[model samples]
Target: MTITPAQVRSALLARREIAIIDVRDEAPFAAAHPLFAAQIPLARIAVEAPWRLPRKDVTIAVYDDGEGLAGQAVAQLRELGFTRVEELEGGLGGWRAAGYELFEDVNSYSKAFGELVEHRRGTPSLPAGDVQALIDEKADIAILDARRFEEYATMSIPTGRSVPGAELVLRAPVAAPDPDTTIIVNCAGRTRSIIGAQSLINAGLPNRVFALRNGTIGWTLAGQHLEHGRQESIEVGDGVDEARARAREVAYRAGVRRIDAGQLADLEAESHRTLYRFDVRQPDVYAAGHLSGFRNAPGGQLVQETDHFAPVRGARIVLADDLGPRADMTASWLAQLGWDVLVLEGGFDGDLATGSDGAPPPRGPEGRYKRPYEGTDNPAAAMQAYLDWEYGLVAQLERDGTHGFFVI
Candidate 1:
């Protein structure tokens, strides 16, 4: 069974559900792939396929450059009960011959959409040196690290607190109570930083906000010091009601819809369309208790890694939160990134699930991509290359016309 690259492109252009899986390890797939291709290495196809491909009936196009893995992958998937599995005809060469866009690095479109957002909005930012200067002078500033808590604990900018993405609007006002205080957001690389800072500005916060330019990569390249092993602490300011209101307004401006529990049940009943339900909150809070059937996807990382979480691009996403603002804020970004997203406004009061989802089985170090923005040890050349890739994404997105991103 096989599907042509043209067919895959048509499906994508029509906004239909399709899973284009690169049946190679992450490292090779990261080197180059179609804009929406998700990596599900041949070796772990069974394990990841069940998790990634929520519906066995959805169309699946497995491909490989020349590794001879696609046939086996198709077999494994069929044995696992996937009913509509097939190989991408001619594999990588097929996509290339068809003249479709190919993107490098992981989370390609999400990162590209971030670049597009910054490009269109002229999202404000500051260099690491300047941010360090503010810290030295004891300037009124609050730095928020928008990456995962584990990433922040590994390394962070001086005086930066782990505030993750979705928490920015919820916690920024609390972190910087004085309107005159500055709020600077940083992530491992540019995407989250830009999205985080812009989240505040979009919500119309009183404090001045800026993304840390090039994020931690630029911070290190500039010879600035980084702190490590700090515990995550975020200030809970006095205005939960105000923050909720601001987040709701932002989502509304971005065209995100709100749904109550009954509406969500209706969405769930639609088996023809894939629906992803996520609790966009911190892991700790989620482990304590989240609405039944909702997976924990902290708002910040969910936006940063939408491709990994939901590979079926046109699939609908419903974000759940007992707290008011997190779902709205997360939905705002997802909507802007061209996702069909909604906030669950009335589901938290029901029976809740407790404990972690348990960490996924690690693929280990064998075939992982060496992401430039991760860790503190990447070479200067790799870091610059990563930033250069990001710089050119706006043009790449333009070339790939399938992206539906819109900036507000």
Candidate 2:
């Protein structure tokens, strides 16, 4: 079968669960690609297909950089057991010809959505230049890399410390003591930065918080350097612990529900439709400890970009947050947006094991499907306009009249 770029665009807009594979070499693929396309070079197709795409029935669309690689790769994928493989008509060239914006770098959509969130919600951010000055002087600025620990280990800002996305709520206080040190949160790209920074601001922390503008993207573009060695383990204090407890209470106040392991199993078994469970914690934390049958989706982005993560729109979403604030906040938004969202309680204390079978199931491969807005520079006008809308969301939430959400 052959699918046109228009058809692909429409399918994505409609939230169809199709795997978009860009069958081009790394260099060409890196030059430019769609916001949501995952780059798996045609050479690696056979080896990576069964793993990156475990589901044989998922509709797969393969595209090349104007070359005829797509058609050949599609055939190979079908031959190798992908039941519904098809070539994108006109290839990646066709997609660009259709006038859809091509996004570069990684996690573009999440990054773009981060920019959009800041634009729409007036989410505050700190300039990278100013942040660098603080670091240069060895000032009291705390640069928190809010990505997974593995990502931080791979690459990070020189003065930054690794604080996985999920730990932001509980660890933010410990990271900044006087409430006077500037706390800037960043991810490899944008969504986590916005979500992480906004998380602290939303939770009513005493410290002044801001997202690193454009995250590491801006950092790189500005000709800045990064640190590659192991990050020192941060010590948490009783104050931070108290703050976490209070944050959990706030989450409860915001209408989050908690279900035990048995109840979770009941929910899974009772539902006739397929349900997607998520551990709304950092990927590293998830790798270390998580409930069986749960996928990792850090909290802020889950709420910010619900359609990508839970494309079904109507699927039951059960989130597990070791820190209740993140889970509660995420569920509250998902519920408002018409998803049947729930929070699984008491699942991740490191000491607690979830599955009734006693041994934990092997974890699934992490979702590597890239989002849209990763690398392109945004125009100032568009960004400011986006932030304006986001600024009033709280009041809009009040006016939205969809307060079926309970705090927990």
Candidate 3:
């Protein structure tokens, strides 16, 4: 069986459930592919398929850029009991021939949605030099690094504390208790910074918030220095009551639903539908205890890498958290990005699982695009080019025309 590129676009535009699988190694898959193309390498198909593509009857379209791996992938899926499996008509070339854009980099759709959010919302931001001057003057401000703690510790703005994505709403109040204190959100690049700041603003935090524009890349290009070995992370504070109210309001605005255990069970029993259960909390917290069958997707990173976490674009996503607001805040963004998302209500105290999840199947560095912001030692030219590419994502998203994203 074969599915055409036009049909794929129609499905995405209509917000219909579809998994457009790219059965290439991560490196080559990252080089260029459709915005929603998910990399589930041919070697890992037997293992990853059951987990990522849980619904055997859900539509699955496999494609490759003339490498001829699509046929093998479809064959494997059929053997694995996937009833609706097919190759993309003509594969990746067919998409380009149909005049659809092949976006570069991993998590391409999530990155594009972030750009669209900023474009639609006019999310406020501060350039690296100005933010530096503010820090140098010892201004009444809190610099919240929205990247993971590991990334923040690797290299971050001087004195900035680690506050990953979903933690922005839950932790921002404690980190910047003074309503007058300026709150600066930044990541290694543009998307997280924008999404982090916007999340806070949408949550109605009283403090003035702005994304550190272009994030660490902007800092590097501006000749500003970044600090190393910073170990600070914001604590989950006593602001749960307020955070819950605010986060719920934001989620409501984005049309996210609240689902009880029974509702979730009904969802799980639907063999024809795909459902993803994710515990959106810090890794350590999730490892300590979380509802069974739910994978850990730290809230902020979940939004930053939604396509990776849930490859089926229209799959139902249930986000769980013991604490109040993390799941709600994460759900809000997912809903806005055209996802059918829900927050699992009060499941933390139930029978829970412990221990960290093993890493995903590794795809070696072959054709991967080395993101300029990952390490501290990238050449200046590479860093600038990455930012330039991001600046054009909004335009690309417009041209793609299948992203049903709306920013609140």
Q: Which candidate is the best by TM-score?
A: 1
lDDT value, residue 15 of candidate 1:
87
Off by over 4 Å in 2: 132-140, 150-159, 187-192, 214-230, 235-289, 295-343, 346-408
- Model 3, span 76-124: residue lDDT tens: 9999999889899989889999999889888888888888889989999
> What global local distance difference test value does model 3 have?
0.89
lDDT, candidate 2, at 289: 70
Candidate 3 error regions (>4 Å): 357-367
TM-score of 1: 0.98
> What are the per-residue Cα lDDT tens digits for candidate 1 across 142-234?
999988889999999988998989998888887888999999999988999999999999999988999999999999999889999978669
TM-score for all predictions?
0.98, 0.66, 0.96
Candidate 3 clashing pairs? 165-300, 166-300
Query: lDDT values of the candidates?
Result: 0.89, 0.65, 0.89
Ranking by TM-score: 1, 3, 2
Clashes of each: 0, 21, 2
Tell me, what's the RMSD of every candidate? 1.1, 7.9, 1.5
